[model samples]
Target: MIVMDSKAQLTVDIIAKVAEHKMTIVNAAKLLNKSRRTIERYLQQYLKVGIQFVVHRNTGKAPVNKTPDSLKRQVQALIKEKYFDVNLLHLAELLEVNEHILVKRETLRSWAHNIHHVKRAKRRRAKARKRRERMESPGLLLQMDGSPHRWFGDKKSCLIAMIDDATSEVHAEFFPSETTVGCLKVMRDCIESKGLFKALYVDRAGIFGGPKRCNFSQMQRACEELGIEIIFANSPQGKGRVERAFNTFQDRLVPELRLNNIKDMASANAYLKHVFIPQFWQSQIQVKAKDRASEFTPLPTHINLDDICVIKEHRKIRNDHTFSYGNKLYLIDSPLKYSIANQKIEVRNTSKKGFTAYFAARRLQVSEVVETSKFDTEELEIQKKLDVLALAEKLGNISEASRLSGVSRDTIYRHLKLVKEGGADALKRQETPNLRHKNCVDLDVEKTVINFSLEHPHLGQQKVALQLNARYGLDISPNGVRGIWLREKMNTTALRVEKSLSLLKTA
Candidate 1:
């Protein structure tokens, strides 16, 4: 005996009612939502097959296109383990290519919604500014932005990227920080590869001309020199193309970077340029422009990009033909070029030219003025001693007082004793025994630290010390590493990288 569903049971009752003349065939057909011909067929089947005919022949059979249980389990495991944070769309593509699991994104989303309880993303409401149309041709308009995110590892990195409004072609690189230099580099790279874009659209970030008020910024200077218009977006929706591109990148690039074990900015940039842009973005995502013809102007042959893209500042030359920069005096090399004193000239810092002064457009030769020190070195020592004593007095505890001051506990105790002594020059010690006074580290150890500094200029002293201690059996404190950096004049990250860039390139 087979149990019948409500529809089948209703059909049985209706045909029986028709046989007893309680209900007409028309009324049965209407109630069953079937034609009169279908009702007649049902009646005939009821007579021949009895109650069994009420049930369809294919009711218990599996669907021809049903997903396999094994495949479902595999995909679910992958979703949990590998793609827990990946976008469903990108996850589907990644599964097909990387794991050989071919499934539709919609199917994956359905499974995810059911199993993982992930809700589908709803469309955002339109902003106050109405939507804008894309440019007709690539290079006619380009959208540039920087998104600070944990693109690869835990540390946040800035991705400076530009997307063509018409084609959605993207050019981007990872930077340690979002600065005017990074912005300039992105624009330069995009312009060099795809020819000069006509107009650049950017948000009201200080990196652009936003913070300059009425004055022009370095970015604005470069754009103006290159004959490109700088368009500022009043709202994020004004430049929605690149904003949406960054949203997609945040969803897609993070997982790919993790899977590929890309950690540093260098590797991340290389992967973006060689792999993600070509294989992922261009192949699968970029769109064709409505107008096939590109509007990018060819870079002028005579234009000097070095002069245009640079950090520029104005300085007034003194009567002594000297100007101060970076706290060092630079002398205009004397070759009696008129009495050009008291006039303002542009001081430009570029990668190629280094430090150069420009009068109008002509380059001016300059020399550094190294002055003799007039103050005693003991001043710094006295200040350090004063700080330790002040901190101990403030906290009323010797240990926690100089804890963050980077001074040793013994040094703090000695200074505290001296202050209590009340001598005429109690703070004036015979001489401080720093790492230099202590036994110098072995030559091999010093070289190893210098090489490490050159390799990872961005790492802090403590982090470098920790890595060295873990990687090699190096017995060095953070202060010891800092002392080595001070001796080598590589104390700061910028100085270390700037001084070693030439050495690195040469090697």
Candidate 2:
């Protein structure tokens, strides 16, 4: 029996007719758009092999270049195991780089669909975006942004990233939340790894630019000192490169993390640095620059990243070589060669490192003043309580005041009674309570807690409790020690709120 396509069957019938002399070979060749010689060959084949000769010899045979079944199975297993959530193109790239199996993205897509029933829905049509040309060289400009996403599992983290506008190479780090420090850290990482870029293109977020009224932000200040320009995008669309990169990350990185069973920022970041980033760089996401030369400038030996990337505040040094910040006193360790007494000095504070004082661009040694006596703590607590009551009274609502000040309503009422009895001065001069709860730790321990908190403002209640137990042999519940710093107005959250209010007022 002959197995052939309709065109082949028609040609065979014509050739058989020609063989029978029913039609001229010339006319049959004309009908099939072939030469007379070709028609003669078809006729001879048909006469020799019967109907089977009409079918092509290699009709049912696999092509010589067909992918092997073993290779297909390997691809299938890899798709199921590692690249389960990755897109077809990215998966193909991963296979080529990591598994040494080169395949077209379309071919991989078809095979995946046939073997694993993987299907991709058509995307909705979007407005045509304007084309933006890439920069001529790497590190000319970097687009920076923060993507708040559930990158691991239930907890949402901010992936602060910076990508070169030319090469599309990215440097990103996961933070518990997006803040000035997170942005600073991302930029710092990029600079440390790839050298300092010429400029940073970012959104006009509060961290990049202060509230509408302010002239500059911490980022702007740091950038100015580092000799890097800060360009604020008029809109999110203006910095679409970073935004699009974020979309890809959310689509691919999330599932990659899920498959790896990564559930926290530390593990996610480790995987990102070690595995994911290297593979992604090998992928099609990054583009090669026209010029291979980098626009990033090498850092000078004298420049200290720790000093540059920090929150700076000016304080006047006391005659005794001491200064106060956030209600904590710091004394200079050694007598200054040239006294900076009563002169303003810059106090630089970093999240990782505690605090450092600088006068005339010279770093100074300083130590925190630790209060050892219980009487001093009791007196300080009384002053703090009075300050809270005064703030509450100024706000004109007890509940609002309690919420803002982190004080209990009952405590507010009792303080109000004292204020009524002897005015605000009485509240200020109020005596410490005689009896304390069993949960109350020693006054020295409380001072230590305050010092720890001031030094490490980012530490949470649980971490603070852990540090206390580890360092000082003092066991205290997190809640028991949660609001001790709040009373002293030393908590980072409260300080942030105050900072925001000040900015609003300025605006």
Candidate 3:
């Protein structure tokens, strides 16, 4: 009583008719769209198995080529877990290459269609413009750019790349951020390994001394020194070779790095230099140039890239084989024969050599010169003022004092007026005392403390206080002695000595 499908039912009815002689084998074969031999074979099958034979033995079974449910589930989980936002083609390739899953692109696409949202490849807008041909030979022109991408998982970094226009050979590295040094390193590697290219093609970034840059940038100066031509692109599309290469890298290189577990810049750069570029990229991507011979000039023996690629500025040498750099005084390690004072010397900064001075490319050894603090000189200015006043008092001639002390006439007149208004006490700089506090320390006790502190300036406040108490039977405490010194502005040994000298000079 099993209800067969339409094809099965038709086959059973036709075989029954042929056995009962209701139809000829040719007519039965025509109804079932079978040949005479097939109808006869069906008749023999009918007799042997009856209606049950019409049903296929493998009915209600799955196809052998059907994908496994477990695998489908794993793909679904991987898409949501790790491979989200990746297109189907890239996902499939990543599965095969990274995860060792052998799912086809079409099959992966079908599986992803039922998931939340299918990740599609990023569609780039085609720019319609006049197509320019590649450079004639390798090293004719190299296009360079920085691509900001999350190549190392979630952390974003820039991959500065330089690509040969003719051969499409590339050198790239990852940097924390896009900077002048990062750009310089990329070019430096290109120049060192393959010699100097004829010209460089790049966008008008401020690093390249474009309109945004106020002065000539180091990158521009470096290229000029190496005799490499710099061609600034008006628009990004003008340097389309490297731009498109970056797009491809973001699509393909990101997954490869993720698979290889490359997180930091050092590991990423090593792989890029040793494994990826030479092994996979050069073998797969680079094409033959129109001319096989390279246009790269051989690097000269005399040209040291280390010197050329640095921050250079001119500094004038002082009389004592000293020069100030980065606001710090430094002395030349050895004396010079010729007159080096006031001679212009070039100073270069690099990570290897901290700061180096050069005179016509000859290195000058130097060390940081620790200059004396101005605290030592601050008292000097005050002493000069006192000396000028003392000279005027001794000479009794205002004009002669003005000439001798180098003190301006106006300043001498001001000090002389202050002396006339008050006595010599007013001439010495001292703060006005609190006249309301009549219970001040006794003049005899203050004078003894000042004399004791100046004589034993090497001793601390506590020792001085103890000695004063022991010798003079004074009851003043350590803080009381310190307070007296603070009032006298002789709180330290140097300060006490300076004050004593000034007092002697005035006397």
Best by TM-score: 1
Residues 460-479 of candidate 1 have per-residue lDDT tens digits of: 99999999999988999999
Task: Give the C-alpha lDDT of model 3.
Answer: 0.85
Candidate 2 residue lDDT tens string, 214-331:
8588888989999999898887888999998888888778877887789988899999888888877547688899999889888889898888888888998889888999899889
Q: Give the total clashing residue pairs for model 2.
A: 0
Candidate 1 least-lDDT 10 residues: 429-438
Candidate 1 segments whose C-alpha is farther than 4 A from its true place: 1-5, 19-27, 117-125, 351-353, 375-507
Which runs in model 2 stand beyond 4 Å of their true positions? 1-5, 59-74, 77-82, 93-107, 115-130, 192-196, 210-215, 247-264, 274-295, 300-303, 313-347, 356-507
Report clash pairs, candidate 2: none
As for lDDT, the candidate ahead, 2 or 3, is: 3
Candidate 2 residue 181 C-alpha distance from true site, Å: 0.9
Question: Per-residue alpha-carbon lDDT of model 3 for 97-196, expressed as tens digits?
Answer: 7689999777888888888658555689877899999998999999999998888867899999999999999989999988888888889888888999
- List the global CA lDDT of all models: 0.85, 0.82, 0.85
lDDT of 3 at 278: 86
Candidate 2, poorest ten consecutive residues by summed lDDT: 495-504
